[model samples]
Target: MSRSTYVQRTIRNTIVSEKSFKETLDSFLYELRFFHPVHADKMIEQAMEAKDPKVFDTLAEEASGRFGYLSFGDHKVHRYLNKFNPNRPVLESHAIALGTSPRAYSMTKHNQEATINFPLRITVTQRPNDDRASVTWDLPSSQIPNLHLNKTLANAAFFVDDKFEELIRFCSGTMDEKKYKKILSMDKGAKVGAWKDAGGPTLSKL
Candidate 1:
């Protein structure tokens, strides 16, 4: 019964040419494979193997899974952020007990206290003759029945925004590789930091 609300923005031709841009985009997607639920490598492999028009949709479905949607092309990438389950332990144990997949279990109970998730998405694009690429951040809406539980999960959206902003800064050469690596290295709980008080306006809109 929970649904996601959508938010979006764009970054201009940051990369020089189409070829180089796609390569850079590929590298970025490659890095995302380190995270669970992304399945970036598998998506890429399948996309390449299919070599058909449906490849993009295949890639999107694989990358998004239950979280949301992610799609890539010669000049753009679209990400639809859904809630992320932090309690991997609980989800995994439940999966084992129920004889179901963890991913399936998480999808069913992503909003539960044992598995709170956030809503945030980013889109990157490059237009012809443009000197920069347009990057947009979208925070969707979702309902959490309990007020206390809602408050705890709300800050996660902004934290995700900050992390993506950091990634953009890294791509733009403003943030050094070492610092960016450190941010990427952080666990989910550590990433929330002091921003917990920032509140969940996006979630409230749900």
Candidate 2:
């Protein structure tokens, strides 16, 4: 469903702390594995073995073309929710499509549960400095069921920005111990609505 409540944020000209351009690119691909395990895992492994960033770039290009079929487009919302509520019924039938152009990616998820479906897109571009990148995130509405369960799922889309920032900090080796531990704790288990509440700043700005 199309609506006006889209989220858009730009992290402007953030410097890449990695030692080299290859390392910077590799770090981005490596962090993506957490959100898109199936497609990114093999590429990550191959890149590690070959010590080549091009391997990851090639795989990323392929994923960008067939974005929907990639692991991220399928049941990713369900997977995220399952981490908090494993007993919920599995999402059996859903249609998620995603595609990416040179510097932008778009995705939409739709299914029986109204809360589980939404539209999100992101774009990251290298800045003139070559050692920095500009990132933008968008979520084109929040029309989900009013139930608590659905609210969490609906809010999950907004977490993409947080995840992206986390990835960048991690790659830069600037993530503090406290923040790292917090991420780990959330990954393990947190109260319902935790994500929604924690993501309020991002949503509020939207």
Candidate 3:
């Protein structure tokens, strides 16, 4: 079967059983593989170490901001994600779709064809309480003919519920200026922003 078909079938079988939660966790891990292996490895470590669901939720919040950490390739049907908390989320509601070009953004620099990795259409919504937001994920029918995916994936928000019990301490908050510069030199994309470029460093928003 095609990879797409396999993804569909795997999702179908997984979501319908007692292991639904576990399946959801696996689905995200599988999708992350399209990106950097380091990300997937780290995520798995987090999941395994998470003492409970609450810990996983915290990790997801942090991971969502570092999507760039995952090594994403040319194209793949990974996932559409939304984090619904009564407060600000790591990811607002958004749609992941197949496209010939990228979307306009300070990130993409309004250049469509420059990067075609995992392009998604993002729409930010604010509820009356103005704290909760819901993001929708769907393939624009006009873009793909008869797109069939487990619609459940759209609602499969917040896969893992807690943080991993085991954690790696490769990154630290303090460093000598020269040491920091050396680390930044490792990843040319290294940038200082909400999301650090490949090797650069950034602080988490509170």
Candidate 4:
């Protein structure tokens, strides 16, 4: 069963206190850096350093990216995307897909074509009403092509959701970052399971 390359979730917060809001944004940047992304910093710096008027939205947008953050209107968005299709997003309504490479995630033993950088976007919206806010997990693209071939992309997205449940901890006020589960252990375990049936030519000599 083929799955759409898109996934999105919106979590509404009833009590978006000023302090909690600030902490959320700070934690967001912290989480992005925690993975040691390769391309986000330069893009963030250029956005910070742009002196002249950034007139057009396009010129305003690339100030470079794929694994970077940007702000517009009520939303603050950051994405690590590859193979972007500019026709307009089919799932998430946010349009922050500035084109470039996708090398945000760390390399894994399972996705060793060096091609498994997850194509994801995080959109935090402070709604028109100051009291309401939402965090949307927008998966506008996936790291794997099985998105349209089978339901693997959807399955992978589900796995990611499970690993990162603590992301919304600001809503509850106790974000024990240390308790967050290891994100790629499932992938490693899946690889090991496949190894049990290792074929004729690829068995390890060791």
RMSD of each: 16.6, 17.8, 20.1, 14.8
For each candidate, the alpha-carbon lDDT, in order, equals: 0.35, 0.40, 0.27, 0.33
Off by over 4 Å in 3: 1-38, 66-206
Query: How should the candidates be ordered by TM-score, best one leading?
Result: 1, 4, 2, 3
Q: What is the lDDT of residue 116 in candidate 1?
A: 34
Top TM-score model: 1
Query: How many steric clashes between backbone atoms does each model show?
Result: 17, 0, 19, 0
Q: What is the full ranking by lDDT, best candidate first?
A: 2, 1, 4, 3
**How many backbone overlaps does candidate 4 show?**
0
- lDDT tens digits by residue: candidate 3, 1-206: 54441222111110111123233223333333333333434555676787554454444334432122232232211222223343543432222222111111222332232233224332222233334332222222212212234222221111100000000001211234564455446544332223222111222221
Poorest 10 consecutive residues by lDDT, candidate 3:
160-169
Model 1 lDDT at residue 186? 61
Candidate 1: count the clashes: 17
RMSD (CA, Å), candidate 3 to true, equals: 20.1
Best by lDDT: 2
Superposition TM-score, candidate 3 onto the true structure: 0.20
Instruction: Please give the distance, in angstroms, between residue 70's alpha carbon in candidate 4 and its true position after superposition.
Output: 15
Can you list the residue pairs that collide in candidate 4? Answer: none
